[model samples]
Target: MMEDTIAAYSGGTLPGAIGICRISGPQAFALADDLFFPTKGGKMSQGPFYTMRYGQVRAGDGRALDLCLACCYPGPSSYTGEDLLEIFCHGSQAVVACILERAMELGARPAQAGEFTKRAFLAGKLDLTGVEAVADLIESQSAAAAKNAASLLQGGISRPIRQMREKIFQQLTHFYAVCDYPDEDLDPFVNEEARKVLEECTAELDKLYQGFQRGRVLKEGLPVTILGRPNVGKSSLLNSLAGYERAIVTDEAGTTRDVVTESVRCGDTVLRLSDTAGLRETSSQAEKMGIDKARESARESRLVLCVFDGSSPLTEEDRQVMETAQGLERAAILNKWDKGALDFPEMEQAFPKVFRLSAKTGEGVSELCQWLAGMTQGEGETLVTSARQAALLGKAAESCRMAAQSAAMGFTADAFLADGEEAVRLLDEVLGDAVSEDIVHGIFSRFCVGK
Candidate 1:
């Protein structure tokens, strides 16, 4: 059978000024020529590669379907390393459907989710890391996440892995050569040099592994749970941070009965803010369950925003909330500062980070947002955003450490050599040098159609 030509709508679905339908495969250009007739009266196949032509897409009966623009990208230079064509048409579902149907009739099949990117991977245009980065870039919600994904797509993580693999391979090659020569004037593999190289590689791998903690937060917002007694402006605070009324705020006590979550961008950081029911003892069964859930959320959160009603005198309930937040990574927010302050020396002593703010007036919230952003900021560090990459890096680091330990203990060359080889193998998997088909499919499966 002839190679299947794939087609899909690649642009946003909403009614916009324009929409894009992309086609790729060996027959992509031929299919475009069959459907798109240039207004200047020429076939699209005769158009220069990478050039867009004003055209009217037609049906099989030569009926004008839509006035559109068409662009062609020849094979080996296209995104999928195949002849690719893109039709820029009116952003209407009817127009998109008609174009897709015409392309199908001309021998184009619908592209599967991530099939375009998967083909790019198979064509040697992108590694597995790069392919994952493409997915991340599409799904990124914050500037930090997009920046990190773009860096990974540009080989920020793969370059270091490739370098480490090369170093291990060099050491292995020298060891093998020395063993084969016996006395043929090849310099012996120096145990000290091998140990140094392995130690360096192990340290680098450990750094990348450590980066996952911050990387995960950058990619998928930092989990922050708001804790405070009823009527202390917890919901108002959540709305203030989110810049919208995500939670209903009223003067009524215990108004929030469940955890309300919203993700908001603060500088480069994305905060997954959970506004839980005010922590308080209640006779109502539902309120009691919500209170229990509040505590559970606090425990699972990476950071806690402990809100205090600065207008009211410290109560036993306030003390209990503060006590619950003790020993966790927390910051105190003295809310309702507009109402006037009350002395709370205990809060000052318990929490190192405290912000006095009025959620109603939007006062002093910028400082808290800045602090949250600073928590995950780093300078030019390679982040391991994928769990698979983190696991492989952990294994590679362990193997390097074992190799270094073997060399330091004066074990035979074979002992350290085996560990070094294992390290190289793990690094290979990290860079898609040697990975299973299932893993590759799983990674690409997360992508959307037309990527």
Candidate 2:
């Protein structure tokens, strides 16, 4: 690799105090030396490998800049296979800017956003799926999501994809052998044997396919709306899940006139619960908009919680509300259990997945958690949660389908072979064995600079 790439990355952005200002390439150590001007103990930068040198930072001038730490990483086994230099500086914006400015002055260029990780991938230190996992780990909101991302980052996702691609390519070669040399002699085409191999490949891939649905939900949580008439304990439910009063709770009806969203973990799944205003025919202009938003959230949810005041008798208002939530994966909540039920008895029959509990008292919340957990069990292990990966895999599946059909059609071996080779190439695309520059740019562009 040319040092010009380093020249191209003249000066990079700093993300703040916690982030390291890294300069990786052939001149990493030299760049560090040029940028560093210590104001403290003498000869600290001359330490052994894996040692941190504590000192004051400096600008182009010999003047002290900020107190900083410089850590060195060398060669082939490093995260980015290039010689890497990490300057740990005071997280202040001014300190970061001065160090970066000085580095560029000394011929050390700034690293691009995710450039280190990209370099790692290019150097064969990581696979495509592993690269995606780094992004996921950064974006993960919940513990479970972080764990899933970590698993993928550790190559839990890529190992399987690699294995599957290898098997499919091997089968592809065999398929081509059959297609190219028919009964005339070079190779014998055994339909049963070939079908068995093809079927097994498809079967294993399909198992991974089945996991995508659950994985998609985990990666992007299922939108579950918590809705009901005003004063039906919607805010109470929100507070309980958020573990604090995120939404204002009041005895007054219509206190919450807009949708309030909070995300919580139910076992391994992240549930985005939207607590919305009570649905009703309101004359007030503001209330009407709130009601509209509430309805919209409910309609968009993968699941809905229709709450009713179990302590109060069922009214026509409740019936109207329940009717609106039909045809969804729904659970009915009989809130205010502490107050005791009145003459209203239609809740159990109206919505079958009825939960008799009090959000205020925190009863029966366990059952709700268990149900939501079951909804997304075994989803984290899937490889296709990423939309980009799924789209590519789907394309590979279509190419496979084309090859299968061409094989069955009794087409000339040359034509059939073209289809088979194309299918293999598409599979390579899915595995990222061959990637377009557009894809590389699209994925890495989303990353923040100085990654």
> For this target, which candidate reaches the highest lDDT against the unseen true structure?
1
Off by over 4 Å in 1: 177-189
lDDT tens digits by residue: candidate 1, 1-451: 1288999999996488899999999899889889998898877887776988898999989999999899999888889988899999999989999999999999999999999998888888998889888988998988778988999999999988898899988877766765676564333347778888999999999999999988889888899999999989999999999999999998999999999999988888888999988888789999999999899999999999999998888788988999999999999999888989777787879998989999999988899889988988888675889999999999999999999898677676677778989999999898787999999888888988888
Pairs of residues clashing in candidate 2? 17-91
Clashes of each: 0, 1
lDDT of 2 at 147: 79
- Return the TM-score for each candidate structure: 0.95, 0.84
Residue by residue across 1-451, what tens digits does model 2's lDDT show? 4262242222234444443677778776766666664445444235454667776667776788877677767766666787776777666667767777777787766667778778877888877788888888787766666777888888775676667666656656665665556764223354333344445555655665666666677777878998888898988988877678889999988888889898888877788989988877779899999988988898999988998898987767677778878877788888898899664456666665777777897887778778878887663464566777766666655555555555555445455456556656655665567889888878788776655
What's the lDDT for all of these models?
0.89, 0.71
Compute the lDDT for candidate 1.
Answer: 0.89
